[model samples]
Target: MQRIVLERAGGTPVTKRAHLGAVASGNLEVLCEPPAGDGATIVVSTSVDGYEPVWRATLERFLEQHFIAAAIEINDFGATPAMVSLRLEQALELAR
Candidate 1:
């Protein structure tokens, strides 16, 4: 995972962008950025094309449970939920 943090010297909220995992049939790309006023939000796009509802629900729950303060964009290519979780965790770790 790799991330870039953009912030001034002040204690303002930082903007974070991260890329994790691959773009293969069973990988994902996760990019995170500071939330805009609201709480954590997760948007997932999958190549499979039929799991958006489940992916969004699962990712939203994960973000809320982890108290992640960023907007997450996930580009997934048929990865399972467990794999997605692991990749997300890795990206979050790199962001920190």
Candidate 2:
């Protein structure tokens, strides 16, 4: 397993919590909640190792567009970048 952490600044705070998707083969899950501090903190645990760059890129792009301040957890099981982005968006939508 690989763990990745990302911190981003300047975003609208998320008021509600949300959970979306599932951590199964070729899939992943997202858990989002109000931030513990200002900005956003994202923690990812993936079954596939050595994919930190990919995970970072995918998350940075999403955050750049959405700009939401929340604590996000992503549990991944061999999920693709597209799926990751989709799940993040869904979770953010539900959270907002």
Candidate 3:
């Protein structure tokens, strides 16, 4: 397992918590909650190794578009980049 942590500045704070997706069979789950501060923090735990760059790029693009201030947790199980983005968007939507 590999763990990646990314932090960003500025965004609309998440008022409610959300959980989406599932961690099984090439899928993943996203958990979003109100952050302790004004920025956004994301913690990703993936079954795949040496994919930090991919994870960063995927998440950066999402953050650039949404820019939500929330504590996000991603538990990945060999999920594709597209699936990751989808789950994140879903989690954010549910959070809002």
What TM-scores do the predictions have? 0.71, 0.96, 0.96
Tens-digit lDDT track for model 3 on 3-64?
Answer: 99999988999889999788998999888999998899999999999999999999999999
Worst 10 residues of 1 by lDDT: 2-11
Model 2 Cα RMSD, 1 decimal: 0.7
Off by over 4 Å in 1: 1-15
Please give the CA lDDT of all the candidate structures. Answer: 0.65, 0.92, 0.92
lDDT of 2 by residue, 3-96 (tens): 9999998799999999988989989989999998899999999999988888889999998898789999999999999999989888988999
Better of 1 and 3 by TM-score: 3
TM-score of candidate 2 on Cα atoms, chains taken together: 0.96
Candidate 2 lDDT (Cα, whole model)? Answer: 0.92
- Compute the lDDT for candidate 3: 0.92
Model 2 bad stretches (over 4 Å): none
lDDT of 1 by residue, 1-96 (tens): 322222112122335677777778888888876767555656666777566566666665665556556666777778898898888888777765
Worst 10 residues of 2 by lDDT: 50-59
Candidate 1: deviation at residue 43, Å? 1.5
